[model samples]
Target: MTGGSGGHGGGRGGAVAAVDLGATSGRVMIGRLTDGIVSLEAVARFPNGPVPHADGLHWDFRALFEHIVTGLAEAVAREPQLASIGIDSWAVDYGLLRDGELLAEPFHYRDDRTEAGVDLVHALEPFDELYRRNGLQFLPFNTLYQFAVDAPVAEADTALLIPDLVAYLLTGARVAERTNASTTGLVDVAHASWDTALAERIGIPPTLLPDLVSPGTHLGRLTPELTARVGAPLDVVTVGSHDTASAVVAVPMADPATSAYISCGTWGLVGVELEQPLVTDAAREANFTNEGGVDGRVRFLHNVTGLWLLSETLRAWEDEDGAAIDLPALLDAAAGVDGPVPLFDANDPSLSAPGDMPARIAAVLRSAGAQAPVGRPAFVRAIIESIAQAFADAVHTAARLTGRRLETVHIVGGGSLNRPLCQATADRTGLPVLAGPVEATALGNVLVQGRALGWFGDDATLETLRATVAASVTPVGYEPRNGGTSL
Candidate 1:
């Protein structure tokens, strides 16, 4: 458990490619489902982040689209038998299109441009009522809020969330994958369809919405023009287009009803997967989101600010040092810190933006009557503990809201590799923490495609895919410490 191995692998059989995109990075991997083993082999990876524009923070969709095509082409070349491909990315940010052409670059969700949108929408329908209709947590950057103030959306004839946008460009298809579309706050919670009335009430054109599709549905093969460019005419399969939803699909939980999951990457999507949505007032009051899941399940989770804090803080310190810090060495040093380090609220709004993260975190600490961390080790310790604390809090709230005797916490995605953070979460939550399958998003994407290709047959449930995952990867285990909730 102290060490790990395998970022990509080499294998081939009933193969499919997964184009998994995160807020900060993107990768294309080939997944082979054979001999009861689901294996992944990396094809390509590229950097992704906010690109400052004259307007505000925006994603470089042009660059990302090129990278994705190149990656998929490389993947196809590597695995000639690759059956199909699926795409997934961070949710709630989208591109607008007019006459099948993008009107503008998609705004980064982190951009501080949604305040006006929030005000404008809540004026039409208060957040409480909106939640009743949509079941989305009140994120200022939810696509519905963004549409409230995005002038370009008024002119665009179609709106596509990130993965849908990528799929559309590749296949000439204009369908919104349901999992990601649910994050837009324009999908009805109870019905799992577009809330056209809500759109019109808020002054967004309903025509901009596209047909909704489910995971494992075949979107289309690459258009012939795209085929010549990408080197193949492979079909595009819809997975859980939302990255968190896909990550949840590969949680490796044998019994989801008794376990909670933290899809810990840029954000800690902490919650449980349920047969149906949990939309009680208590759930809404706790800021839990009832996002759509594959197989018509519900991702009843809350989004706690996650590893972005540590990543941004690292960026700040690296700037000051003029070199990249050794993350493992720093974390090892942090793990040896003697006692409880000063903790700050990990979900503080002031800490959300980019730049000077250490200063901003310290300022928050000082304002909260805690001593500022004196050195890098202590600072890192503080960061880990604070984030772990937030994760623990969210896990407890999810359990209480859902009325489950949560027996396990599954930490997947990049944060699962942080041994100290996982241990701290186990300690704080007083529950066993199971962590690994770091590429769960890609695995889920691949699993869905594999099923679509009949590798698991048509009746394979998310649980079946997850069981295959369990058989493939061994998750590291952490037991609760003697002093519960203490580092």
Candidate 2:
């Protein structure tokens, strides 16, 4: 066992562990399902972020695997009667395997390699045509463009996205989990299957993609090697492998038509879930995405730059011995400050890369003809306000473009832990807010795993589980006194 810890049965009596990897951190949660309620306990957690390197930002795959093994050991010690395991991670970035070995360290999606590939990709398949066919956004780091940036496709035997790579390591199985695969901009929107023709056109061999699997397909058991090494029973099952898809699966919407969602975290994905891809020019012009979701749903959302702005700002402040600045107190201070600068463009590419965020915000404001904040609290407030304003605009555009009257916005994920952000979002959007079920990604992972094992009846849809675990938070109204802020 990686951690060499011990225990009896823990998760739901029907124990299933989930390995949920996010960009900033990773955790192994042991879930317990008894009767109809699900309970979760964290067996282990560790920092899991990008490693800066000369070639580009690379993932610490070895370290992540070590941590996973250690966490599994702990989970087994605590809940010896484990049923199955599933993994979900951020989308697009992948691992290359050749001759049964990982070819090289997986490149982080934020790497500059993709910077030069967008025009080339557009040249091969015009953006509008590609959008009509695939229904994905024009992110620079999508797997299609990322692969286009590489020298040649013949260099690798297989390309496995993050969650698939992790599953392969766990169960010696290799298949593209459908939900995450759709985010690569290479999947057929209608079928949620890999697009071989597109792959050929982009110069990547079709064989590089493994057979695709739906969310709950059983891959296999944990290898005998892992069983002996860890001395515990292990099982591997597929969940919504894309973290956002999993989160959406657990969105807690009472009715799909009336609900909009903000999978608030490192990135704030704001939009509604639809039965089909809304591939209209207006949807395209609004830059909204029709990302694939569980049960043949389309997650029509925009990938808004989220708390990264605030988190980065806080990091810079911490560097200046500003650790004692409590967030609640900071928000109070920000509320006291008057006349926030007009909404600034939150999606500026300059804000996309990592650096001094406070300085970046200052620069963005100056360029936009808005004055920089007088102090740190003011700056933080400006960022929060601007993000909310942006959300407001997106929600309106989403409604107009999709013809769906979204009655509420459900904010889930790590960023939902920020109360002021939620309140500001609610105020800015002028819609009721429901926050929490903070473990949205993990819960979604577990629900799919649960369904796979037949723990619940066939009628145990994701919406049912979401409704069971969801908690709601209402808006703390904020009305613009002078004038409504605008970007």
Candidate 3:
């Protein structure tokens, strides 16, 4: 489920592997569940990211596919009796096929070509109407705009989302997995399928889109040729192909009344899962999304700019300096720094693209009439503070929009490891922050596979898995030392 760096989850020893491909890295994790605990072991891990091109950013699909095969081979070597394989990746970006061959390199969602297409499409269908039909947020990089800009979609024989494409490569089976496809603006929320009318409206050939398949269905076995080459079983099962969906599946749903999750990594998706999608006008107005989850649930959430902002800033700093700073030590130092001045909105589009974040953040702070940090610790403080404030805003908005008073906010993913950010979120949101299962996406991916493969029967099985591996970190409640505010 980790579409960022890690591939995670399969129960302790029933025999399954998840090929989790993310923006930064890819991994093949072998999972097995025994005595109600899911244990994952990494069989192979590799570095991955977008390749910058003259047109924009492009994914090296061939390289990624090769890495996936290698991982699967490693998994089989580690556990020769693998039951089935599942693949999940970051959502929205896709590949097109003509004559059953990939037409060109898959475009990265971060491509600038989608800049004006959202407004252009809304001019045709109106924003609210689109939202009502799709239940998706208005990110410019959404698949709709990307497809809209690349009109004449009819030329391609098929369109495949990232993970689906990976599954297709393994099994020679084609499907548009519902969980990930839902992230595309082209999917109809109410129908849970690709909107043919919307495709026509966007000038894409309806045939380009594949048949919609729900999660937990087996796509097919890995192709015989691939199996022979890799020396492993080629069978692949489609779990929640989308990383977020798989991550939400792993969220330990302890109490429906109190638990919420922040799937924090590339994008800090913060929300609660519901039995059904909340399609109210308030949800639409608040720009919240109701994405599909495993087993017919909805992930009511908001996609906030996450550690991308912090990591990019750090990368920029490292690029300028010859050496890399110690991240954990720097964060500890930042936690001790004072006078952060004011935090800027992390959603600023300026920070959305690849850039010199340290300079850009400083410029924004200066323009806002706030003092910018000079030292590394102070800079780190600003980034963490900004993330905490954003988390606070998102949690508050999610509560108001969904009409649920979130009792506890669960911070999962890598960001949850940031003690300062977790404490700040707890302080700012005035809620108990339970942090852990840093590999929630992988855990979720593994649990879904466990359920689908009959390793466990029901939700209780998942709870047991969580109880065995998930660790809890209580927030160090921040009080108003100066009596101004608690956050």
Q: What value of lDDT does candidate 3 attain over all alpha carbons?
A: 0.78
Candidate 2 per-residue lDDT, tens place, 154-217, comes to: 7888889988998888788888988889998899888788889988997889999998887877
The lDDT per prediction is 0.89, 0.80, 0.78
TM-score (C-alpha) between model 3 and the true structure: 0.92
User: Which residue pairs in model 2 clash with each other?
Assistant: 6-77, 7-77, 11-31, 11-32, 12-32, 12-33
lDDT tens digits, residues 33-102, model 3?
7665667788888887778988789899999899888888888887887877888899999998877788
Show how many residue pairs clash in every candidate, following the order shown. 0, 6, 13
* Total colliding residue pairs, candidate 1: 0
lDDT of 2 at 260: 81
Best candidate (score: lDDT): 1
TM-score of 2: 0.92
Q: What lDDT is obtained when candidate 2 is compared to the true structure?
A: 0.80
TM-score of each: 0.96, 0.92, 0.92
Which predicted model would earn the best TM-score? 1
lDDT for each residue of candidate 1 in 290-347, tens digit (9 for 90 to 100): 9999889999988888899999999988999999899999999999999779999999
